[model samples]
Target: MTRSTLPIWRRIEFTVLLAALTVGGGIWGFVELLEVARDKTAHSFDTRILLAFRTPGDPSDPIGPGWVEEAMRDLTALGSTAILLFIVVTVLLYLLLDGKRRAALFILLAVAGGQVLSSFLKLGVERPRPDLVSHMAEVYTLSFPSGHAMLSAVTYLTLGSLMAHILQRRTLKIYVLSVAVIATLLVGISRVYLGVHWPTDVLAGWCAGTAWAMLCWLIAHGLQSSRARPLD
Candidate 1:
């Protein structure tokens, strides 16, 4: 047989190594962001970035064209509780029907755990929403780590990584992962644009969400690797 020439990073062992690095880096970044958030003077940069999206005199008015405002609301919904529940339920049903019960359970636990973690983190930080700008959307929860940003990253990345695991081709795997990353990023940006979350809040969300998703992936990978039977 011809020798395989795939790069070292693409191999299973190296991929797991990279995933561990991602988890560690994400956790470190989140801790740093959390410290900055607690310091009033350190948050000036975050305030400046948040203000950039709004008009100088009127914090209520975002700078983009009218359509952009509407689009942002729609984008923000991607991370809403109702929409995320629907997505998880639908994916779980499909996975179950396809006889991939392990994957289905993985999805449920990862997303639900993320939801619980997000709630607790918000409560722990007890950070109030930015009063400097008028919120374009309604929000009732404490702000620090944004729920939208975190949930979107956790949900999309978990689903994407799971799908990539079973896919046969490298290109298709990359495509699935790219879409997941893009969706996560867009949701985070939409939160800032809509004045519902501080820039640092979204940053912390991304870091924590990414780390959680990768941890779940690492667990699933270990289990699957140990089994001789295919996941499906």
Candidate 2:
């Protein structure tokens, strides 16, 4: 059936299923990419780019802190913290406003599920963070897909979509979604700029997270519609 003709519940279910498959396929593709990245030639290319951005520059020197590098490092840290706080507060606000236990549970699951997926991807890739410069912030995990980039995408975009659903003003809904997209983009850029994650890592994070967020939103919307429907 055409989309307009489909029942709301069916449409939601289809969207959610599509999202899940998208994310699952992306994750599988990412894993294959990681395998390719493990090759010596690929590793060299990745390392070369990361080393190029290192701080404290001397053309001959491998390591030194430049002003630009320092600034980028600080920016990344700031962006990371800000996004974290925003997600926490937004989830709490949703819980308070919705007063539906299921809504809160879905939000929690989406965020937590994203985090877990990030962790697993990091381990699977086992790529080390850049060591060319003194790191501005301490980090100990393998850094294939940046956690900050992924989580920011999941939390911010998911909330934005939900807000768009509930809010009456279309402009306001667009504004909310714009902010979410902007935040997610900046966070991913910050990871690359700080020399902590490879550009590809950030890109993969953005892709994976976006897919996951869409999936969660579709599921949540379906649940909400089911609840709203009158008994047959």
- lDDT of the structure predicted as candidate 1: 0.87
Candidate 2 lDDT (Cα, 0 to 1): 0.67
Tens-digit lDDT string for candidate 2 (37-66): 465344565556666754335322324457
Give the Cα-based TM-score of candidate 2 against the true structure: 0.71
lDDT score, candidate 1, position 181 = 97
With a 3 Å backbone cut-off (N, CA, C), the pairs that clash in candidate 2 are 55-64, 55-65, 56-64, 56-65, 56-66
Error of model 1, residue 120, in angstroms: 1.9
Clashing residue pair totals per candidate (backbone < 3 A): 0, 5
Off by over 4 Å in 2: 1-32, 41-71, 78-86, 97-100, 131-136, 227-232
Expressed as tens digits, the lDDT of each residue in 1-232 for candidate 1 is 2235766555658789999999999999989988877765538877898999998888889998999999999999999989888988998999899998877877788888878887877777867888888899999987889999998988999888877887789999999999999999999999999988899999999999999889888887887778553356
Q: Which candidate number maximizes lDDT? A: 1
